[model samples]
Target: MFNYAESIASRNTYMTSIRETMAEAQRSKPAVTISMDGDADGKSHRFYTNRDRLEGDVKIVAPADTRFDEIYITFEGTSRTWMERLGVSPAASGRTSVSQTFLRLVQPVNEASLPIPRVAIKGQEYTFPFTFVIPERLLPGACNHTIAVENQSVEEAHLHLPPSLGDHTISTFEDKDDLAPDMTRISYAIRVRVLRKKDTEDQPVVLADTARKIAVSPSIPDAPPIHIQDRSTEFVLRKEKDLRKGLLGKKIGRVCIFAEQPQPLRLAPNSSCPPSTRVPVSLTFVPANAETPPPELGNMTAKLRTSTFFSTQRTSYTPTVSRSTPDPFVGRYQESTLLSSRCVSNVSWEKQEPPLSSSSSSKPVYKAQIIVPIAEPKCKHLVPTFSTCFVTRSYTLELSLSIRTSKHSQPNLALKLPLQVSQPAKDSREHDSAPQDTSVEEFFVPRIISPSTLQQEVAVMAPPPPPPPPPFDRRQGQLPQSMLLHPPNEMPPPEYSVFRGTGGPPVRIPPPVGISPGCG
Candidate 1:
């Protein structure tokens, strides 16, 4: 085997001569002299040489066995790089073991020592051709997996990962005679490269750097789906499809717009789903095409129920729109000046109660009422004039009803109430009268007529039927003939203001009993 030991002496000749002389004295060997002999034209010089002077030069040499095992662990400069091989020998006990528990190496920064791969002995070194075996477990409890050694002499050249300066931990075994305890264990990161050709004068290019460390444990676990609710309607398992339905042939995709009160949830289907628990929910749904509403759904809404823990639960259902048509009415309210005047004096229409249906359905049904709020007018002249006296002349309101159906089969009723206002009749005392000539005082008689008689007179002067309907095109061009001015004969003859009184001038009668003037 080729010896890989580094040479100790340099190639300087002067030092070699001095060493050879000293070697002779130490070995008690024979010494030689030098002389010079002159020739015919030139002077000659001679130097002494030791031929076969084995003992003289040999004594100065250090014995190959003399502490050849001892190593100073010397570093060459501010930065150091060294490679070492270790071998084990048995100690006095005959059992081989790592005799040292603690080892030391130098590094400027403590963190830089973890990557070195070799170890050196303090007092001994070994030649190449030795294999070092280490115990499987040592300092087993230490948390760090990597060990390193470093040279701290240079401030900037501290040892680091992949430890260029040979930073690594090693174990030393005791020798059999307790003599050669130079063996050590070395830990190192594997360095590799690509080479072109063997034996070529060139360097291999580094491909990659890798650190090797011990390993210990196993791997970590996925997280779980969220549940939401809708307000306004009670529903369960409120999903995006709750209110979506297809039209004639269009497919309606379901969509749920969750409010911001709850955090935005993302369902990573590849990962995991959220938990299904009661949660505070403000969710809403919209038709796939908002501009064109879903025709299948009617009166759709969401009802949400909240819990004390701020969780919400919900259920939803759609109500239908009314489809029933209302009954048509062509009847007219006659503009009767007297009969209308009479009815306004004392009569009123009360609201009728809605009768309960005999069905066994539990759904709530709404009942309605109609009331005629009438303003009656007061009259003082009819007290003694007629058996049934006029109390007040006022306008009143009348309400009419019709029913319609919703698409969800719910009832949608229509209501039309006509509002009417009556103006108060002018007081007879405020009329302006022309000054009468002092010639004659007109004589007048008080004629008495009953209510029955007044009714008879009003029936006789009624107007004729309206003219035949005009063509649609012509009708559009003309105003209704009913609104046009009529002939004097067509005008209903003015009926008597009072059936039993002569119109000589309203008599200045005294106010009625228990009646104060201007009380209205």
Candidate 2:
């Protein structure tokens, strides 16, 4: 897996090298620089949400009298995907690729005010200031293919502008690399080109071109909970595992775990501090005999599974991104990235009393509410849940619990639950709805990359978590604003029968109440 990601990294780096070479060659010409409004560090990237103003200025410097036809500046968004077909001959694993330029905003640059000659004056500088309102949604043409929207006849969800995805070259915060697969890339750029008019039969020549990359995660309202009923394969809301006495002793009772679909993880509008919800879990223990105390609780941990579904053709049915092995079929391709894990410590299960109609020895039940984060703030570049005609991105929450049943043997209780990661709708009247950093620089030049091939890899390891907030009090139902933060501490080491192991693509670490991910 390391080698796989390494190969991808090397290939992407090679692409960067080629682009850099081209950019270096262009540097000798008249320079065109772009300066945008907000950035935390002039070195990092800028992020935007729905309807934010992407205001910037393009400056042109001419060392000599440069002739030009027109200035072309465009804000463009594009998505590209390619994959080696599964059944292709080993010697010729030809790949099929598809790309779409979905968003293009070209508000004509008003050059009439600055009356300058067709040829620029020698050693002169010119600045064309501009402002583009980031639209609330994309045009209908953006997703013209057949699509499926929950409870809607028309495909409305995919028409909204998807967040800039797959490009992880720059990050403003300590967020992990989105672990996006090379098969899919969604990029947005501000490209400035100086064109020279050509003869009647020839196309215009591009004298100078420069591209500035921007990262955007539009404000996506919380979607209705995705209904998942498949019990055997994709989603298992309930499961039973056997518990034992000592290694040599007879079998003890069985532990059954079950949970209803929890509320969606609500991502707040402002990017700085997003909130997550708790998952309510119930456990029932049936003793083999009469005297079996509840199996000791070892540890509880949560994982986030991000499944990206892409298609070369239009969809006739809503593709349910599954957790089972990938289908060998063609046209539809999927990639699941498991981000870094977060240790949920100190999960206290509240004991539940038996019903009057049931016998005391019938069964024992316990309940606990475990919390998780929408997405940890430590890493940036985490795109929210969204769907489109060509591609769809979704998330599933995998919870695992460790049980100290006996000295020699232990069993784990785990379940796969559907999770929604979404942002609250903006009121349009609130100031600072989408927060921007103060220390923005002129521009951070991003390399424009074309698709390239690489071997596959999925490797994950949990990183240390952020600082924990103050102790939470659940009864109040109102958490102190200051007591909300990503939980602190490292994941507990693996034990016998604890979990399925952690060597895969890192999953996102969700939090409980305010800081931790486990029940308190």
- Whole-model Cα lDDT per candidate? 0.22, 0.66
Provide the lDDT at 80 for model 1. 19
lDDT of 2 by residue, 295-375 (tens): 667666667776777766654334665535443432343434443345444666566666889876665555555554334
How many backbone overlaps does candidate 1 show? 50
For model 1, give the 10-residue run with minimal summed lDDT.
381-390
Candidate with maximal lDDT: 2
Question: What TM value does model 1 have?
Answer: 0.12
Q: Write the per-residue lDDT of candidate 1 for residues 267-318, one digit (tens) a residue.
A: 1111223211112322232334424332221121221111100001110111
Off by over 4 Å in 2: 1-28, 39-44, 86-92, 114-116, 146-154, 171-175, 230-232, 246-249, 268-271, 314-317, 323-377, 431-520
